[model samples]
Target: MNDSAAPVPIVPVILCGGSGTRLWPRSRKTRPKPFLPLVGESTLFEATLARCDAAAGFAPPVVVTGAAHLDLVEAQLNGCKGAGTIVEPEGKNTAAAIALAALRLPADAIMLVCPSDHYIADVDTFRETARKAADLAARGWLVTFGITPTGPETGFGYIRRGEAIGVASGWRVDRFVEKPDRARAQAFLDDGGYFWNGGLFAFRAGTFLEELAAHRPALAETVARAVRAGHAEGGRFHPDAQAFAAIQSESVDYAVMENTAKAAVVPASMGWSDIGNWQALHEALEKDGSGNSIAGRAELRDCSNVLVQSDGPRVSVIGASNLIVVVDGDEVLVCTPEGAQDVGKLSGASRQ
Candidate 1:
């Protein structure tokens, strides 16, 4: 990367089609965390847009969501500036989602693929890292952001950083590690040089598609056909149901990033959270004197560590600790924060 090269045009692609079953009640199929106003006054999707808007080298974002969530997506993006929305007819995973966006966008466009549901503190630092990543990505390296690990978190995957490229310590991806057990997670933290994979990527549309073709040919073919069949401008941009159904469902990590040779990790210290569960949400939010974070109308007397979100209904926790109390419109969830890993057990059994 030349020191004097002009800044590249980064087309932000927000992936907002998660079901978020673990964060049930508050986070449902139709109303996921991305649509929920959890951390701030605005929804996660809105904050994502705002971040992109504030960042340099960013063009209007291209949102890839489901056909069902079109209204919600539009609603969250209401006050914010306009951007393109590509609705999928079915859930074909991140590979299809990104492919659709890359196809709809121009060939030479530098795309920053991000999840809409993530919580990223320190937007300025994020923007600076993104600008640097954009510069590297323009030179043909598929750049991925690796969040500085705060602790031995078993819930999130790890990216093993390898070899320095420049002043940025551009590391070759040693491997993409899965969510570890506590002992393994602690080992990873102790070993150092490992960062939590935040799933944010920066790359050129054409180059990414080329790598996709080389690695997962079937996926590339299917996505290519789907994009070819997608509705054009001034028309519906949703993928064909039959075509999308024919494609296999897989994440971008498994589909391309993990397999590509040119993959690199940008080690960053940005505070990020996937907000995978309610406990994670509680940890992310601000707490009171008693280490309690209450939303809506709630009160806590002797609660040491607890989170409550109600809908104007008075909730009083006198002696609760390390608990999550969430009251959605039709349902309420009260569970110990430690049991949050199996938080989806109820929903899974209910489906059965």
Candidate 2:
């Protein structure tokens, strides 16, 4: 990147879609994971907003969320001045959500598409990295933040680095790997050429829309129509319900990046985590020498890497490792680390 190049205007596009079923009892459809204080005192959604503040040379953020969660969205965005919310009639996955925000902003605006519920420990590094991504996006490349892998994590997709582009370790994407088996993930870690697909993205609105129209013509047109028929009041913009519902669900990765010749990746090691499940959340919180972290009421003896969380009742654990115990309302969850991945499949996770 040319240090002398002028900076482009960046508008953060926050996608708040999933109900976060993996978090189970604590996360519900009405009160999703993004709104919950999973990582720290402030909710994840709030942290996301602060990370891309206009003070950091960003324009007001455009948040795309479902209508059912409007109250939570409004509540969290209360103190954020100039932030705009694009209300979707229903959840349509990342592609449509991003398209909605892209179409709503000025064509030249650089849209920083960020998931509302991810955790980043180092805010400064994230801001700096985001700026770098913006620089790439302004140059007509679709950019994604490539998180330095801490381990052979099977939960995330991986991006293979191609030839270097721009400056400071940016790469033309060679290929995207789906969540691989343990052996493949280990091989990727050993190769030292793959980065976890962190889901953060950057691109010019016009460029993204053009690519989406070319690759996902039908979805692109319907989203454009939804935006055209949409109405805005104050900070909230509501897309046409019928039009939005008519659009087929798709993710931005499949709809554009995978097919576009402009794909690029930026490597970053800024202490990021999805905080996706109890086990993952346990890793983020402060832990004792025994490798145990407790919230609310809990007790552990001879335990290693055990997470105990309760909304009310006290719990006790002895002689256990890699265990998760959670109590929320009428539901209580107990499982091993491996079992954590399937928490979303439980009957309680789907309850409204």
Candidate 3:
């Protein structure tokens, strides 16, 4: 290692608390989406940890997850020494989930909040930009990674970037726009100044709480109380269930980022994907000339843009276009790419 001042150690507060409803059948209550290897050999959760290794200037991760998924979290940790897991009694959305992690670290600790199941193809680019975000966070900026939009994707919210701040320090977030219709999304894309909000963020632990207290005081206070009353056993910390459950379910985006004056964004084209549904996963995975990607044994004939993921028996498709078929030993799901968004609504998605 070169003899130089080490970079700030960013504590990666990995928010591992999503049902991944849209990715169901394969993603279920027992082994949600993050724990499954949807994109690559290692699971999305494992890939997330690798992205913030010590070499990348990240501190040990603090994983905030629901109690139901604690076993999966621990099993998948696979000896990531020094990592800590915080178990929430129930699902309370991102705001409370992140607050749980923030409360456990030092007030000055820089927290790099990340969603557990997203796929980032360029790890090097991610690390470089992550450090930049951390520097901005250290300077009291609430930084979010602004992913360069590749298309007019109405499925995600967009971030409007403004004047550059600091020396190569990222741009001021002009405003955040909610998910728009296809036409509006296309208009935003054509304007050439918007980016997809990938839900990745960086801010000091204390800075975050201060803003939360300012914008959502009730939530801030309740989370704090939950932490104070909570207890820890070994590597897992259990927050006061009743106190945590009392807090309203809201995303950090609404609770702070959209309300804070310190919001900044680092634009990155790091091959990012939320892997939100079957269609998105198909796009992320490698495809044959016919536009078909298969994870397990699958045979397709005269198929165009088909995705087949089977963890059990071989799947076969013929004369299909823009389709998604999934088979996970216990369940089977089939739908058109457009119909993929409602996969979670199926009764089987909730089953173990």
Candidate 4:
């Protein structure tokens, strides 16, 4: 195996679903986090497309998103070359989304799965990691990128890297741990084998489908039926609404990765952040000398570790630290960084 040979390009499977409810007010049902330009000039979704451009040994991405976001997804992909989209009738989580992509692509095609709403500050490292993951995938390994943990963060799941797989830059996954308590998270960091599960994966289309069939036959069969009954329209593949809607929803971590023996991980540090909440968004963005991030019509005075974003009004924050203030349309949210996690719970209460 000559490692210096031109490697095959992997198909990018961009999962474009998510309500972004955690960053409520700004992130609404109609306009989710991926479509918002939270950190940079381009929307996160656009940034994702750019990240997997053709020059990086990647095929044009296959975006899996719900019908509700079809227009927005298409709009963002305006100038993107060679990209295809699969429009789901309803959201069925990552398992179904990846199945749809796998079923559409050639069996031997390698798929690079990524969530649409993550922020990666280092593009070069990200591409290098993906390339390594693709190398493992080419050899029939179900590969997931294990982000080197910079801190003991409890919000994301952790992956324990086991013995090396005899590859240059790959390892067998010891185990997948769910989001842990603060104590457990610190233990993982101290033990130095665990990496943050960034939800990025690489595998051959046929390999993943086979593993899915072996682990969750019902889901695999149902999604296959839906894809078979699907049709292409205006560059978008539409899975049969009725059949897809009936398929059971599950995450890939639950359906395949945990159950498969071929699971491998490529560890890398690329400044990844899910941007799950306002606090995370604050941390990902650039901050002023006073440690404040202000967007739109916002003014901060004597503020440290504060984030203020206003889309509809002039927001002024003074003498505040460790706070998140957002004003969008008729809604306003003001909370400490610690309380940002509870913001999504407000959505349910408002409906009640």
On lDDT, the leading prediction is 4
User: Taking the tens digit of each residue's C-alpha lDDT, what string does model 4 give over 1-352?
Assistant: 2244335778889999878888888888788899999988999999998899987778989999988898899999996788899999998999999999999999989899999999999999999999889888888889999999998899999999999977459999989999999999999999999999999999989999999999999999999999999899877999998998889999999999999999999997999999999999999999889888889898788889999898868988788889999988788899998999888899642332
Off by over 4 Å in 4: 1-6, 348-352
lDDT of 1 by residue, 1-352 (tens): 3344455688899998877788887777767779988897988888898889934547888888887798898887775454888888888888888998888877778899999999988888888888778877877778999899989998899999888767654777889999999999999999998999898999889888988889888988888787777665543387766777789888899989999988888877877888888888888899988789989898788779899999767888888788889887768788888888787878642342
The window of 10 residues in a row where model 2 has the poorest summed lDDT is 1-10
TM-score of 1: 0.94
> What's each prediction's TM-score?
0.94, 0.97, 0.95, 0.96
The local distance difference test score of each candidate is 0.83, 0.90, 0.90, 0.91
lDDT, candidate 1, equals: 0.83
What would the per-residue lDDT of candidate 3 be over residues 1-352, giving only the tens digit for each residue? 1113234689999988677778887777667889988887899999999999877668999999888888889898987979999999998889998899999999889999989999999999998889888888888889999999999998999999999885855999999999999999999999998999999999889899999999999999999999999999999999998898899899999999999999999988899999999999999999999899988899999999999988879888999999889887767888998899888788777654
Count clashing pairs, candidate 2. Answer: 0
Worst 10 residues of 4 by lDDT: 1-10
The clash count of every prediction, one per candidate, is 0, 0, 0, 0
In model 2, pairs of residues that clash are none
Q: What TM-score does prediction 4 earn?
A: 0.96
Ranking by TM-score: 2, 4, 3, 1
lDDT of 2 by residue, 164-199 (tens): 884544889999999998899999999999999999
RMSD after CA superposition, every candidate: 2.2, 1.6, 3.1, 2.0
Ranking 2 against 3 by TM-score, winner: 2
